[model samples]
Target: MKKITLLLLFPVLLIAQEKATTANTAQSGRYDTNKFSQMYDLLATPNMFRTASGAPGPAYYQQQADYKMDIELDDKNAKLHGSETVTYYNNSPDSLEYLWVQLDQNQMAKDSQTPLAESEKMEQTFPPSNFADKFLKKELERGFVIEHVKDAKGAPLSYTINHTMMRINLASPLKPGTSISFAIKWWYNINNYQTEGGRSGYELFEKEGNRLYVIAQFYPRMAVYNDVEGWQNMQFWGGGEFALPFGNFDVNITVPADHVMEATGELTNRSEVFTAAQLKRYELAQKTFDKPVIIVTQQEAEIAEKGFSDKKKTWKFSAKNVRDFGIATSRKFIYDAMAVQLNDKVVMAASVYPKEANPLWEETSTRTVAHTLKSYSAHTFDYPYPKAVSVSAADQGMEYPMICWNFGRPDENGNTSEQIKNAMIGVVIHEVGHNFFPMIVNSDERQWTWMDEGLNSFMEYMAEVELGTNFPSRRGPARKIVPYMSGDQKFLEPIMSNSEGIIQFGNNAYAKPATGLNILRETIMGRELFDHAFKVYANRWKFKHPTPEDFFRTMEDASGVDLDWFFRGWFYSTDVVDIGISNVKQYYVTETPTQELKNSRVKKGRFDLEKGPFVYLVEEDNKELRARDKKALKIEDVTLLAEYVATVSDTEKDAFKTPKYFYQVTYNKPGGMLMPILVAITYEDDTVENFKYPAQIWRKNNQNAVKVYATEKAIKKIQLDPELETADIDLTNNTWPKESLKSKFD
Candidate 1:
């Protein structure tokens, strides 16, 4: 995912090698030179308007909320019914006049103001969100605004719906630092998140004449309270994900008697809900440390699918601290669980897909989830949840903590593309990685989208790479970013922009940031440093609100590298990397008399004269090579020297030292982004040498920087970061003795 921010300047500090006595201090200073001041300024900007203390402050703070929900899915009517009791802890010092609840599903209502506005603008070329049509047709829509405001004691309280937000007017102001418990009963239509074109909901995957359920965002929940926005009023406009308050939930979902289900939390009443065989199998799965033990078999699913029993079975789940809850259930759902040993505990890596997902999702999805848990844990934090689920759906892949929806399907003849397989694996990894980014490492995504999408996408790339060589990572590879970086600058954005307003949508906001972080990890700071810092950030801010500054600061702080420049150049500005080897000059040392050297070669003469000053006689005492088999020296070996310095006294010999060759190679940074210059220089004797100059070399002069190499062998060729990665954007300048352009078409 690209993280597009507005352009901003960063301070640059260059370090000279001679001045720094300590290597550690010098390296730290060099890395810190390019710090992102813009992020700090933006985050620190005070807002007084929403201040509860009558002073400047952040607008809202998400309270730790707990919910006890009793829900029933009326599949026959395509409706969802739920009544949840929410306990909201007021951490803010100020008292709340009212609390707002987000009715996300309302956006799908036919009469919604957004859809109405969108419908008027819709032409044949532009289609409505996939969930829009499904919401209006296949899903039942009712109780458009069926909610009652209540106090902690269950007494009625005044409430108002100002468009998308339902404001509950408390009977009396809930004082500062207080907890408010209330209940709201709500039900909504169920539609696939990506049916016609929408982003969340359920898709009906048929297997053995049974339809499997893949559900998401089926109910209304609370909006986020943050520093920037008091309450996020941004409507679920289809593609973008959600921003919510962290809380606990006790959800009870009831479906048909025979239907099996899996959701966001553990099944609290498994004994009451599952059959004797399921209980025994569940116990076995707990010990099955390797592969998944099937809880619901295909034959049982087919039998259940034959009759859509109206009898509802309640499956209770209680999550201690969670932001949201989602579930997938169906008689045709094929469920499997594999034990993933994280740290010492065993977390279940599960998958729920139809027979269509067979040969693909059935085999790889769970394993990919396992991989995500492992790789991401190594980089960020451990898999704390008991289970991580991957459910097969169509359209865009979305992530939620411990639960994610994936997209992949086989051909009519059961043939699937390697592309599809890799894509599924990658998507699953990307989604599950989200459990770390916005979910546990809770960030205000609406305000700073990059914090969630960009960071998750970055880890997504790393996780994918760890998965295998052919893991088809679409967003994280640096080389894959060139096209987007080189695109029309007018249509681009820096990764620091507001989520909704960024240009170039997907690539600019999501993929670029991911690639930028990858470049920083691989080519800039390296894996060891980057991973440690990233993990620190994740662990430090888990379940709390973190801004972009928190992330930038924590990474640099933990890594002990001043990454200001990296954040500034990559996140705040639309800078492209286009560095090249501008020039290379070679020189040789000679020892001869001044006059003869100057006269023999004017270009050679001056060289001869310079050599003459340091000339030493083949001493009479040096008689070691006087053997009969020894060949005589040529004039070139004992050249006729310039005579100017031929008469050196004994005292001059005491001051004389052997001359060394020097070559100055100049490099140009056509790209605004500064990176370490990794240059490979080939010598005349078919030998290669590498010279590294820290990024600070360009701090003093961003135009062209020159480096002098003192070597015995003459440089034959030179190349810079030959792999064509680093998101260089332009490789034309990447080599000395410019490579000849070849026409592939010809």
Candidate 2:
């Protein structure tokens, strides 16, 4: 690949790469800053619950929290009411006296502390709805009301509310293998996602007098209880997402009679909710593998939107082994679905959108959903759920169990650009691909956002590429993350940093990790090895909670590749790759050895200077400004070579390849991170040859690495990371005859 970068001409934007030195270089007592050091100090000690191999240990146990809920939508009042019975199972060995429940909705409460954590600034523009929600309206009547908290017998249970978390005081010590059940009732006003801003809420189609509700984190939920962190009771400060345990769900949601809804599970009352024509189309969708089947056509949806039904209908859904729940309900929804076959199983790719989403959504939504499931499945593991649904909502893209909400709206005039179309398709793929990551693999996003978002983004990149050729993906390329990784150090944070502490959330949490994995797959570890290990991890921890170490360990253990250097360099610290070829010297196969080689021979007592076979040659500086003969030197031209050849055995003669050319290449590492050295050797014939030197090349030498290349053909030019796969920050020093920069205007 040709070198292409705007930095070539823009010298002011470029800064000299600060060299990364080894810990051994320190004069006296010092901290261990070895980039290749084991992550023993940072990783938790392996125990019965989590093993060193990165797979779940023999005694691994995760608590389960089952939920049975009754939910209702008061569209007129813009409120959501819910009552739920949470059954906690003590799968862990330890007994518990209290359980923590997360009231995520509290982030939007009138007295929410979330607003105080952020530093806000005034923007230049706002729509009427934004202004109304900002000033004209009273404080949003947000957060859960907590109408009551009762035991299975309906007796009130003692519970205390502290910000977004609720502590349920147990009547007795819940012993191991035992279970307890309790109920809670709550209600709260839903925000308009476009105006108030949130992952989930309503999108108003004011002219049509209807609203589309895409809701999650709308009810009180149980927190995760595991061996790693007994109770993941991290406060929902808004930046940190949720941490929940996996269990079954039985929910009944009531919405207007004219509305169509999809939730986290299979709709049990499809017969009662769907019209005859809709039922027929759904059956066809199950068999339609080529394209989407329109379950609710735009005409029908438009007719239904006009009828604000006074009555309500209940949508019954049941799900198994899911960490969380979500629902999208609206009378203005145009529903479509298609069947996708994965191995022996069949899954549905579904979508729901309003007319405003038009032309764009209808063309790509469900297809992108299908493509994502297939791509993620092929890369990771099979899609475990029965269906993956995409719901269209403006300005929001959030994932749930089997469903997620996406944003991609064309203009009111139904006009869309290539950018808009591609973005919408990419968002749908990303949101739907989340199912394979945190949804099934079950990583705690509240503690480490990259564990989910970053991994999902990487998978999303693959899926988007698999979806089409030359796709304009925003992440997962090693070179794409160079700007952020090489930017101001103070403004950057390591990929392992906590969710709320990150300075560049998107670049740090999503792009960096994705690019790191890409580097591992494409450059460090070959695809076959990397893919097998990645799939092993997904299969090992499916439906279980996995920590960052679990993923790190599994990847190494399964691939039989030691990635301590990579994980430590890329994740634990903010490091940039800046390896380049500083110089290259060519040597002829003369019997006269260089002074450095003669010194090594003297040390071994092999310097026979008084022997009859003495051959001496003079040296010439390569700075003579002349090119050399492009052919191998004949053994007859140098008497010492003929004498040596006659003395060596025929077997050794073949190995010598006499009269060969040798080039000593010097590579200097100025960046903090170490990467596999990829050298592209351009021969005099203009034929390009590439060789990769593993990152271990720098193990003995902390700074500069020297490797001698012997070839039958003369070399023309030498370059490092010719394909830009290592995310090297400096390209100026990469070539042997260092490449010069020229402005385009010149």
Candidate 3:
């Protein structure tokens, strides 16, 4: 057949073959309805409170709840007692009939339903200790013991406790632009965090008869009331975190006289609590920016641990515009602090750890804190608080307003492996970066885990990489997420899932979204645009509440890029990217028709030969046609072509270059996800050219696409996603000449 005739028939033959294959198939259906559409159905409609541009609308308002607490840590009893007076200012347009308080300590109650909600399965072999801890231990007395709830006038207020939440009824509906004052007196038995597994508690050292307390969620806190989910009274089921309104705090914590304490706020009476020598060291640390200055040396801490001081000292602290409060206190803590300059302001980076955390904690904890503040502040907003503290605890990595609990303990002899060291630094960065995420940016972590954990983890990866090469980052690299992205569908959940609903907590809540943002920064949007948009999101939402829509809208609005496709695929669906080169064909230029064309014309009774100037295509494999053309024709022998070239203008000739080779490249997508097509084309001269087509290229053809290119050099090979930027799952079909697979033996 003639080349033109064969080309025309190819599509028809393909249609026939496709129809035959469909007839033989047992199961066939239409396309998935949820695959390609926008996320309108899944997202709430934009309103005046939150505009389409992702900025807070004119009507946006947030409530404020200030606290004045007098907390006492009963070290001998392993308990916490507090009397808090909350001053709530209602700034919303609507009236509040009642106030919801989060009693998170109730999650550990002996009668708590959290344990019942989990499913227990029998193990093949269980250790005697594990079996006893799981099934034999007597239930401990847990949850808050509410003493009294009273109004500002000292009148008893009506309240009811249900699970992990409490409702306080008011005498009248609290009007907007009004304030109310109430008091709550409560106490709870602090569990051993190492044994009970909690965000905060104490780690006991039986041999030394000492304990390190890392405390949070220790008091009655007000739940967030905002435009979205009016009253975020979601019960604390243990996985999803808190959603609290921003407020100021004045806390007076009374503990053992020998204890060294670091809390969420600035210590108001530092001189009163610190000795002469310790006060001098802390003052020196405030000016020392290069390295940490020991406020309480390990030797002093060890000596203090031996003495059970009967006298108590009260440490007063006051924090402004913070959402939560946490404190770490221990007589065994070796306290150190250093200064870090951030934009016109100087902030302190401090570490409080037991002697067991020496070497690793002393050498890296304060440094990691300083690095995190610099890195996160550069990307997001400045560290607004006075200090960022990292307290070493056993198997605990959790964040609060100005302080966080990190796990990095060396052996008894102070020796740690590289893996342990990396984990220490990584966790410190991750927890400290949280100050920029939900802590100040204030996303609701109860509803969306990725908003806080994922974003913070991504920042952690960046800080880790900036710290040094071979930093062993755990997330925020495209390649690191491949195994989870391509895992069994049954075991996978989209990043949009609730914290409690996730199947694989680590991958779903942290790794996937972090990797997605990395891909956006390095591959999709480029670093410049991504960083600017990210900073915009951070600054716009700082000290405020932001929903998922606000974040998605702010990124696009700031960057001038439409990223709905990315959000829909990466966050809303369990889709994987898999683009490959399906087929390739090469063609050469010719002036004369071959024998097949002549036969085709004669068979069709057509005699239009030599009627007009025409160009023909000859396949590279057609040797007979090439041999005939070589013997009968020359470069200047084509009369029609020479006539065309002679008539063209000088400007046109200078602007155009004749192509020596023509190529038809076809790309196919076997996976459901859509991503930018990054191609690397190689020439026979050992040179390469790269081209990137936006993801919109798949709009017209979702399954496959055909692209034609003309080049001066013969095409040698082609590669799709040469750098693995899209997290493409399957690489076997990514190349034109498929790479060979190695056998197990080989």
Candidate 4:
């Protein structure tokens, strides 16, 4: 009887196998040609200046610009004036005919093109103050006023000004491997930053009749000159930030004797600037790692605010190898400082805020700075600078070299909300983390904002999470960016867009790329590989400018993985991820040739009814033949199968695992993005098994992919992306037995 069954099934099996082989071989030449190709066209070709290995090659060179400035702030007049002497070094391989300086404050000029470039629309409702500022108030005569341009000999030099940029023509061409010295004296009216939103300026306290100044981009600066874009003298449009060269700064700032100030560098004359008690506290702060020491008490600040000292004090600072300079000064600032150990270095974490900022800023600001440095250093490189300062300025969040201004103030009654507290902490971390990014790594912010802002934001999220589980981080999660990514493509811009061209600045320049890196760390590359590669990038580009290619190549080079597809999909395109299980089928194996197999054989005309070893059941037609076949094929009468089982070894019998169930699951990609497929299968025995398919599974057929599973238990249900790891736009089709949806009317 066993022989009869085997003989009857042979012909049908052979015919099915032949048909499958023929179908598979029919479309031999039709294949996806770009499944695993390198990103040659999309990437810049590797050259001597910047190698394909993502490191600066032997011939790589960068220009340098150093500055010595004397600045004065007229608190009563709300104005700032500076006279800077710049010593420019031509380190590049090309000769320099002239030097370009960036007047970033010119964007606020009354006749500046920045305001004209903005398209205003009449809204249905507007705030009274906003309406007045927009329609009724006269434009302020803002921007830089250059007094004179002179050479080292004090003789006037030829200069030209085109809006925000100034060209200083040298008497003789500044040859390669040479240095030139020039001087510029300029001043500009400081705008009311609270009324006019900008990266720098002063915010007034109407009740106190005083001002708190948070200043940056306040002086004429040299633009970046590198292999990518020689002399990146891009206009300082209001949205996109500056692109300055790394240099040492010796700045002398003059302010009221009673006012406290914090700048980019260490104070050269701490003894002359601080009182005896404040100096004692400042000394103690260097050893106080666990908590902060108050340098200037709130009572002292309040008393100083009322003095309005006529005498001026010179607070000298000297910073080394920094991109730009910034200062925050006000008599109302209550100063605090603490020490944090980052690896082997003990760095100061400090904050300068008004009494209104406590007890929130007092508790969190400096702590956030310290935490940011630790978290960022753990993932990238250590904090190379001596100090990180956070100054509380209303409606301000901006980062310079070692100092940054943050916004988070309590109500007039010293009351604060959880949201406000989190915002303060989040912004502080973000700004301090920037010290590791463009401040040190020194990427070109004018050309690629993401290279600085996006990376810093990603580091900020990590620091926030390290703060605690419940920390309210605004970005860095895969799911947090889905709303923006899956929104109307018309309003959405790719992450690779220019800083000025992005529609949603915060979401595009900060959140999306950060989220992409978070996804890379948590899902695609895993934390170990991603962190190592990220550290390599941070160290490799420290104090040097790196383009997008340097970051992309270094990540792959360090991780030994090809990530071109990831970069292309996440950065270069506005594609959303939506992978789902389209269909699922389950089958069980049987020894007998069932009616389906018999019909397949009959259709192909490959089986005969009288063939030897024939097996049949009473369920089919022809009652007489069915009865005879069933009687001959009865289990007890199968002597050939019994003999074979008796002859088989126990070990061989144990090795056989006849799978009880087989599943063919098909995954469909409704969205035009590629991601790994994560599946979880639940069986009848209440057990679960997870399967992870690499992103390459969809390389051949991007729209749909099928995977087969052989299991011991019957599959009850299948779930895709069970952990919500992927940013799948749609969840409706992500289950084998589709989830039921009810209509709104129902």
Candidate 5:
């Protein structure tokens, strides 16, 4: 008889185990609940606001500027000379009194205020410089000088010159919403940006006597005027980026015939610059997607190295719908190209680095660029430009529209470390990806760094993962962010801080927002939904100035998700995540015994005669229901209990049920942010159950919450939020039945 009973129990255990496994599987898959839900909410919310509010949209404003620049690079003296005519278009609503031109390289001049001002910021997040004086005091600072300013008609205009900035006063006030034409002559001293500690220009490599030129902010350009920030007057103080109005750039760069050059525009004169074989290969590259073909081959570069050409050829490029322009040119450049098909359009992905940047650069840099194009195109719109270039520099990584400068160098023996390789690939992918972010998305880096930086960084993380089969990414994943998320509370700041002054500035401004977006894509919002909504935002505001509200509204409008809480918590507040499973109570119920003895006791004055007969006595001496009793109790002993339960009609059957066991679980939220609670229940038979509560479960109770479960099996253990992907800063209190019992040492 005992063997037969055990056999019957085995089937029940099997059934319980099956249900438990299914529940645990479901629980483990529910991640990033808050992010996607918020994305959904953001998509659902409607907007009545008329104008867009951020930096991105203005950068997309349509305008065209035709530039005729005659530039000369002096390798001997480390200086540059140029004269240019600009046909500027005023596409904004407000009128302009004078056009502003950026003399970006002038920041390296002795008189520039940037180094002095930035050096005073001792609490900067990145490298701080006390050696500014030594760098600035160096002779031949190689800064730009603006000599003349004139209209298309040759009449001179009054202009003011400051270090790295030149203001050209217009002869006549150009009214709002109109185009103006002008020209200027300028030259600049070129200092080594890598070792000399400036934002733009180049660094001197030890062996070749060759300088890597990552020339940007090189031309005089117009300032932006929009609803947000009125005029982005934030001066460039070393590390901050740019804010400029959108326009076309028709530039002609003159480098030695042997030098390989790439810039921010379409190569209109490729036949004049590239050999017949190279041009043929360039045409073939459009059809080749598997790998890159060499444009300026290693053999060709070595041959060019043997003999320097004095004869120069002008490479003309015309870029439409670009906000900024930059160029990189050197005889030392080794060039390779790959093609990426986006929306069926063949976009070229190129890499150019010196011999010092080879081996590692040859492997990852080109592939990383190709990966970025594919991933970003899926998340945003297709690549609009014909080419995206990544050039290797030694110092800082900065972005332009068609080209960007990245930092990564091999060791002395042509050996590169993995960290260096990853950093180089990551930076290259990041900067090239920025062409889609602020370059075309047109967010104002001067006002809201996250609008472009955060968004681009988010894409960079995704691109990195997609580039390699098992890429070890440093940011974006939930587990990867725990150290940063759990840092000292005093150092933490919300991602919505003003661009100019932010504490823990890099974390608050870049990493957090990027992580938040990653959480949205992987955990909160599933890829399909997030990708669609993001692509919609990109397409909707492709050539327009998009404010934060525009992004917030568009995301919701497209995805039909309400995301106000997400924007409020992640972007607006420095909320930590510290939710805990507070408590769990288990109980079982059975029928009360009959009261024949109670009546007899009442007559003996041991019971209250006025009390109801169905009353369950609280006496601890009740023998029928002992403390050690494990048997299921019966309801027949109490006739009144049976009648009470029988009184429920068919209509009330839904509310009336027999539950042998009961559990009350309490959850607590010690952090400012709210995330979904994932609960796992394990039974005595090695069975498990899982339940999920939305982030809104804590809306009414920020400190703690309560939940009750009814089950027949005994609960063995309970766990809360098992996966570490939520970026929960604290994990010690996550499990119920606390495991840590510290021993007190005297």
Candidate 6:
């Protein structure tokens, strides 16, 4: 009761302290420092391009860049040559003088400046191969070698090459409704992915003398032009990924005659390229749903890889409204496909892997792809593409529009550990799930990695659960992120940080945001509300670029919840949650008012007790020293109690038994973050009572929140956050009358 009375007087004390601090500091500008205040200043100003409701406004516009490419892969030389025709359409309000093209392959150039960004140094421990590649191995002739740039009229067009980006000088200003067309020719050497470690490269099977190529960013592509940033000209720094415009693609790829190929778009020349036997299997696969139909079997692939073909064949593909394109080709591939139904649409889920990937890839790859599409489509939108492909590439997981490369290979005997199986399933779901994120919903990964990786990872977590029973997902649990959130604060950054500058990129971009969204779904907003709101954001931004502010606004706008406090604490600051029960005490009825509470209430005239004659409360404890004081005046001797008892009629005496117990509990937050207080009260009878105080409980008092309970049964213990739903960092102080911690050694 002593602690409770003084806590009631905190307002006067805070005012006095604030005045003293204000006078000493001489700082006068007023600001909304309250955690529950609306964060209007921190948000971008709403405009016609992006509305306050998080949907695209009436005047919103996005630029489009269509491509027609002829690409050839030289197997012996390990080089790629391409000639592309790009048509740029200006859908924006402003006219453009020049167009920016992305030369992403230049990142592998010998003169690439990417390494200078990190000022990399040799580590203490390294593999012999990595050491050799760093110090002894000669630099390869990689990156694009531009031969010519020609306009639509066959005249040479002037262009400037800057490391990973090219600026095409237009003959005249391209108006809002006009379009421009140009052509470019280039070639570059590909890297060995296993030893080099990158997004796209060739994996050499030395034992068989064959190579599997997974290619992306192979051509000079167009950069994004939008209303928000005008021109997203950020260079390809390897860490920060791409920001591109959406358009149609028509590509023709030339490869060895026996090679099997899978790419981002539908294969228009499949009948012309596939054998008569293969064509029959492919048609059956389109109607198959339960299991995959194998087009190229292991026995056939084994014979094809033994000898190289002298002639070449060109495979043609066509895609509509896709942001990017990718291709995977190898003579050693075993191909399979199955149909997946999403509402009325049936998408082809396909896989391409060598015999080395069995039985892991053969057992799970295509199935995982089907499950991810269903789970994500249930939450976001339907899969818009004709097909999605997953290819086996060791030591890498990278996603393009409809095609992605993953790592999953068994030992020589075709057996795998539980760890490898789970890893394979999780990575497949994550990469294939990317099709729903930046591939279709289209966020700028170069600027905000979390919008794609984080959102996709969250959806991936859900898909993993639907794909397998008791799946071992790596993220999306509140408790799993505690270690990273509680780690050295100097190395952590806010989730809104720039992609390249982010510290602990995986946890910051992939895990932390996923965990926060899970908390919102499970604890804050509940599943029904969070699900509907999340779906709204997906439907609004599909095939368009969305920013961080758009997501923040859409969530609150759809959920009918003021989540400014959450966004401010979790996304804007490096704050951790640490809420606990500070203290608990029991009290009894008293005839006279305690001097402390009397002083606070009488002076302020603010006491508003529900029960009558609630003058005071005296704390009680079982101590020898308090025996005399307890015997001096029993609670029955209090005149107020006796008078109330006498006034009650005999018939109502049973109906109104006097309250025998009163307990006051106080909760305190040591960390900077604010969260709802979840409490569980245990009684001597072993029954428990659960109570939840919404996050607004701290609106008036940010440091401490107090509650009073009157119960018939005595409470044995009180615990805060019994389920650990808020990602609280410290658990040692979570219980009042704290028990001794017991570890395994104990």
Model 3, 1-746: lDDT tens digits are 21121112111111112245467667857765644566677778899899988999999999999999999999999999999999999999999999999999999998799989999888878899878888899878999999999999999999999989999999899999999999999999999988887889999999988999999999999999999889999999999998999999999999999999999999999999999999999999999999999999999999999999999999999999999999999999999999999999999999999989988899999998999999999999889999999999999999998999998778888899998998999999999999989999999988998999999989999998898767978888787888888889999888888889998999889999999999999988999999999999999999999999999988899998878888998998899998999988765556666666445433333334444234555555666456544332232555555566666679977886666567778899998888999999988887999999888888878889888887878778889888878888888888877776475499
Candidate 6's residue-wise lDDT over 350-443, tens digit each? 9999999987887789988988888999999899999999999989899998999998789889999999989999899999999988999899
- Model 5: per-residue Cα lDDT at residue 92: 59
Error of 2 at 407 (Å): 1.1
* Residue range 553-603, candidate 4, lDDT tens digits: 999999987888888888888889999888775433333445655565554
Model 1 agreement with the true structure over 362-439: per-residue lDDT tens digits: 668877888888998888778778888888876658777678888887877778899888888878888888888888
Candidate 6 local distance difference test against the native: 0.87
Candidate 4 ranges beyond 4 A from true positions = 1-35, 593-658, 741-746
Candidate 1 regions with alpha-carbon error over 4 angstroms? 1-62, 111-144, 192-195, 205-211, 227-229, 588-661, 741-746
Worst 10 residues of 1 by lDDT: 5-14
TM-score attained by model 4: 0.90
Per-candidate count of clashing residue pairs (backbone under 3 Å): 42, 0, 0, 3, 36, 0
Kindly give the stretch of ten consecutive residues in candidate 6 with the minimal lDDT sum. 1-10
TM-score of every candidate: 0.81, 0.92, 0.92, 0.90, 0.82, 0.92
Instruction: Residues 533-560, candidate 5: write the lDDT tens digits.
Output: 8888888767555667777766666676
Rate residue 700 of model 4 by lDDT. Answer: 81
Q: Per-candidate RMSD vs. true structure?
A: 10.9, 7.3, 4.8, 5.1, 10.2, 4.4
Give the CA lDDT, 0 to 100, for residue 728 in model 1.
82
Question: Each candidate: what lDDT?
Answer: 0.69, 0.87, 0.88, 0.84, 0.71, 0.87
Report model 3's TM-score to 2 decimal places: 0.92
The TM-score between candidate 2 and the true structure equals 0.92
